[model samples]
Target: MTSLRHNMAYLLTITILIVSVGRLGDTTGRRRLLLIGILLFTLACILCGLAPTLWTLIAARALQGLGAAIMMALTMAFVGETVPRARIGSAMGLLGTMSAIGTALGPSLGGALITGFGWPAIFLVNAPLGVLTFALAYRNLPADSSGEKTDRAGFDIAGTLLLALTLSAYALAMTIGHGRFGPLNVALLLAAAVGTGLFVFVEARTASPLIRLAAFRNPVMSASLAMNALVSTVMMATLVVAPFYLSRALGLDQALVGIVMSIGPVISTLSGVPAGRLVDRLGAPFVIIVGLAAMAAGSIALTVFPGIAGYVAAIAILTPGYQLFQAANNTTVMMDVRPQQRGVISGMLNLSRNLGLITGASVMGAVFALASAASDIAMARPEAVASGMRTTFAVAAALIAAALAIAAQTYRRRRAADPR
Candidate 1:
């Protein structure tokens, strides 16, 4: 229960702070915030390790999330700012590859550490690593952001608070939705809707809104964000459901399932740079379309076959689809916006991801539960669960198709306007 609380706290804080901290990096300096975030993350790890109570751990996790938000948002903004427009996709791809490696390694590493030294070691391990990263960043990076400083005429505190409330409510709804629907979930979901409406209303009025509404005025950027959200939904849903399908329906051992699942990340990590090269050469629209096509094909393939070979093929293909789509889409969005607004644009990208993740998990989980007639997915019959999995993949494919349509329209409009 405490572990779940900590996870929720981290997720909520991290998603909400990305915008605020990204804006701060735009105003103050990416270098300062980047180093500060790393230092704070390291210190928070130590605090988490030494904490005596569950509440203490939860609070520390929340703080750690703040640091992570600052680091993630600003780091991406920095890369977008520093890299040439032509090469930003490649740079983003490399960054994604490194992230995949770390994510893939974390669970295995944490398990080993917990067995040997305790849960504290899971966090203690970050301290030395964070120190190394901090040193490298300080020694190699410049002192100031490439973009101009944002005017501090107003800080949009109200807007930030509303945005935070909105995200928190949405996350809470998802968390509570894990069990049967009740008043609490309904209330939180209502609060989320209200908060969202209020955020848009307030942002349109505020001078220093966290996100500039004008940023989305560009068809390309807006379409890119939409694609990002849809693609992420499919990606996350597949991620959550596949293990159940593998272990239960396919009768694979946990070890074999893990290895099978690892194929996606490994393939994604390997293909990142190559996908970037394609994006640079062919342009983001072409790359994005190709990615969407690959994902759609993979979804269809899995729905039809739903066996070991099918799973492997789907992972191999869909992983690159996700990687390519993300890299190209990030490049597309950043390219359309002004350099000064890149921080917030980057934040919006991360925000879209968070929304997709939470929605995908909750929505797809509900579908699986309803279809299987079981509260716990693990307890569902293999054939029933397989049927649910097929339905889920079909939905994912439909989403990709929708995104591709939007992307195609945006591409057509852009090409017609530019005529370059």
Candidate 2:
């Protein structure tokens, strides 16, 4: 329970505040807000390191999430400000590479820090790095346009509150049950539904909205967001299910499972730059389909093949495809966003991805447990685990196929409209 709280605290905070902070950046200044976020994150790291109680650490982690939300929201928006329009894919790819590297390194680094120094060392180690990041960003990030402040509309405080509530309720609904959806989950879901309706109603009436309702009218943007969510859900299934498959189905111990799990992030890290360059050369629309196709193939491999070799092959195929899709999808959405709307749109992108992840962890885990026919997955038989693995990947494949169809449809629409 403590571990779960620790993990969820950060995720919940980030999911709730990400969009609001991004919008705030647009009004105040992305660079200024980003610098403040970095400073806050640095302080949160120190607080975490010195925390004497588990609750305090959790609180500090939430603070870290706020900082992370600001950074994540602005960083992509920065691509538009700093990079040339032609190299947008490359910039997105580099961001993806950095993210992949962090994901790959986090586990090993955290484990080593715990072993060598203590739990606090993991948090404390970031202090210096955070400072260095702050310095670099302050020195290099461009100043906000003078007009950004002059022409900005008032920040939508009411809309921000409603959206945050809606997201928080939904995230809790997905996460609180631990695979079993009971009354609490149902109630939370209902609350989320109501909140969503209220948010739309308010946004439609407000002079300055958190998300301009008309933004969703863009078929490309809407399709891209939907595809992003679906792809993220499928990608997350690998993270949630593969560990159990490795340990129970294949009878690998913890160490072997960790090594096997590392392969995905390693592959993702290696593929990020190449995937970005592919998008640059071939264009985002074409590369999006290619990435989805590769993912579908990878999912099928996981469903049909059993054993370490097959598992590795599936991950090797799936991971790079994810990087490809991420780079292309992000580029597609951000490439043409107006300067004023860039921050909010970037936040929406991250919001979709994060929501997908939360859903996958809950929904995919439920699917795996149900398919395995085991009340307790930890004690499930090898055959049962294998069955669950196959079923989960089958569902994953179906999700990817859906994403592929969306990509194809979006591409067709774009071609029809531009025909050049």
Candidate 3:
């Protein structure tokens, strides 16, 4: 899970950058960049499959992240530009559903492939899919004609460096915390804090910021971003700790753990389409608030119960909310921004979610560490772990509640601003 998270962190970062860059490219050149990104992603997958060591794999993953970022950014921008405003809600819902499906299936598929073959199969599977996607994207996507040149002056290297440094430092802290870092961990944490502060400062000052600070002028966008980050944090925390609780606390075997874990994604897939449809009729704000409320309820339930059955039930309850929130939020953010800025906006949103995930995971790990320290796992047994997990869940629930409040404010503000 740690390895996957690390890879995804880079992947998401790169995907955002490439796509945003592609968006700025000459309108006619955007499709070409998308194609190139697809090709690079495919090649990166091959490289990842053949990687000889962990370091090599990480490098390959970084390359793949770049490709994925490009595709995601450009695709989001394209949807905003090509789809009509009225239909965009539906389109975003569909897109969100598809993403949910991929996420849902990914674990099961990867597990099966790993069981049947080896870890390499996990990546090799993407080779064929990538080829098929490229072929279709090339044949179907129209050539861009927006006539916008790549904004050479728009790239904020200082901001990008600061952002990357902050994320990397956080990732390092999480990955290395399990070891006997002692006081070194404190130093790293401090460094991360300093880096984050610098990033905020640089972003505020950069002439053409990588992430448009001006976007926050829109209350809806600002609130939505905040809500997205918190929601992501809660979701990631649950994802990280749930399996541990099931396998360690409940004494479930690996197979049962997998089965129990499938519940959330299954529910998410089932709910995504319906949520999307609801968003279209009710608007994204309404859907998002409902989703956040559901997630909060689910997380709280998990915290209170701390039993296998309860956890499963909580996941079932929580999954739909998350799916809905994702679908609605995507639509809300994309529609809120102008067509030309969609790529950068999309990148920023993705970055927010990724950063949230990293932060959540690190904090949860700390929770686990503190819990384990309080009671020796071997002596106190799984109850101590359960206690720790419960605390984490409670924190997650609180964060989700905060997200719900933000979502409510966003909706109210947007409605007031556009009182049509």
Q: For this target, which candidate reaches the highest TM-score against the unseen true structure?
A: 2
Query: Where is the poorest 10-residue window by lDDT in model 3?
Result: 19-28
* Model 3 per-residue lDDT tens digits across residues 1-420: 647655655644562354245434433356777898899889989998998988788888888888887787677766777787766667776777787788779988998999999999999999999999999999988776545445655667777667666666665665565533557677777888999788778888877776666787887788877887888888887777777778778888988988888777777767777887887888888888888888888888887865777888888888888878887888888885765577677767776786677677777666765765554443435777788787887888889888887887767776888898
* Tens-digit lDDT string for candidate 1 (205-297): 987787777777878878877888898888888778889889888889998988888888788889888888888898988888898989998
Ten-residue region with minimum lDDT total, candidate 2: 145-154
Query: Per-residue lDDT of 246-316 in model 2, one digit per residue for the tens?
Result: 99999999999999999999999999999999989999999999999999999999998889999999888
Superposition TM-score, candidate 2 onto the true structure: 0.99
Query: How well does candidate 2 score on lDDT at residue 260?
Result: 90
Better of 1 and 2 by TM-score: 2
Ranking by TM-score: 2, 1, 3
Top candidate by lDDT: 2
Model 1 stretches with alpha carbons more than 4 Å out: 145-147
Give each model a TM-score: 0.96, 0.99, 0.88
Give the C-alpha miss distance for residue 303 in model 1, angstroms.
Answer: 0.7
TM-score of 3: 0.88
Once model 1 is optimally superposed onto the true structure by TM-score, how far is the C-alpha of residue 77 displaced, in angstroms?
Answer: 0.4
